[model samples]
Target: MTTKNVNLVSHPLVQHKLSLMREKDRSIKGFRELLNEIGMLLCYEVTRDLPLEMVDIETPLQPMKAPQIAGKKLTFAPILRAGVGFLDGMLALVPSARVAHIGLYRDPETLQAVEYYFKAPHDLSDRTVVMMDPMLATGNSACAAASLLKARGARDIRFVCLLAAPEGIAHFQKEHSDVPIWTAAVDERLNDHGYILPGLGDAGDRMFGTK
Candidate 1:
């Protein structure tokens, strides 16, 4: 089955930054910053289809007409706690957007996603929601989170991330055919350890300086 849509942006800035993020030796600060920056770039691609409506407005010297987003409330949902790293950058670009958080972890044995936290806007059904998670390693967590969001009545869902492995993307496609993915890079595969091959390591640990 096809997932709604998965778009891997190939812009130069995104590609260069993603390469840096994939290096094992990159500094934690650098990695975190790149995640945020890439998130913004991905945000641009993800929001491209947002509907706009023409509006007449006053400019510094005269009245001018312009278009602004029309008829769609936007909600930015970040999968915690690593996803929080991308949240700030997205918010900077979309200051008026509402925020949601999903906290889940995969069981080492069962490999099933277990949700421990989830909170979103009350009017999710009317909003266009963008879900952010930096790494799509196994796709279990992201897919599960997306399912939860759909259950909460969110429509026009978009999933954005920094890196994705083919395995992860395939898994997401199977599970979330209704939602399209927007990401910077799709890596080769997942390693035996559940890490994406050549991945920068645990995103949360690197972002927060945790061991």
Candidate 2:
């Protein structure tokens, strides 16, 4: 397997928010709020390398100059259901950014990912796409999502998740060596049930307070 650069976000704010989300007794509202906070924090790290162009603009009292993103073609693809939780928070920081949704439900018998839905905006060739999903376990969904983005001509693609398993990271690296992964934390392993061991349970369930 290729060595993938899986960034485990270690910022204090992110760490604090993740800690709160891990509390089993936390309310649904609290879980949702923490997820949003984590999303914004993760976004800060992900956008660090975005292309910036120097531009001149007038300040409140005088003329000023600064650098800003070169274009507005950024697209955030949230693997459906659980990924939606991270979407809201990311959009809070980038309200004008376009969004796409990909749904992948795993088949129990075959243990493979099955795509049920997909939608994205036009002209992705020059756009910077950031894919969001709360958990990266087995890496099937993420790999599929990244492959979809590549098929759409998205050369600059990145994946963001709240948590990741070592095996999943390895799988992602082997499948998409060029794509980079930014995650808040990397757990130890995946349990027999395909869930990340010591993970925060099912991120979708915790985010929505469902079983």
lDDT of 2 by residue, 129-186 (tens): 9999998899998999898888888888889999888899998898888889998888
Alpha-carbon lDDT of model 1: 0.87
In lDDT terms, which candidate is top?
A: 1
- TM-score for each prediction? 0.93, 0.94
Worst 10 residues of 1 by lDDT: 1-10
Superposed by TM-score, candidate 1 places the C-alpha of residue 114 at a distance from the truth, in angstroms, of 1.1
Instruction: Report every candidate's CA lDDT.
Output: 0.87, 0.86
Residue 128 lDDT in candidate 2 = 88
lDDT for 24 in candidate 1 is: 75
lDDT of 2: 0.86
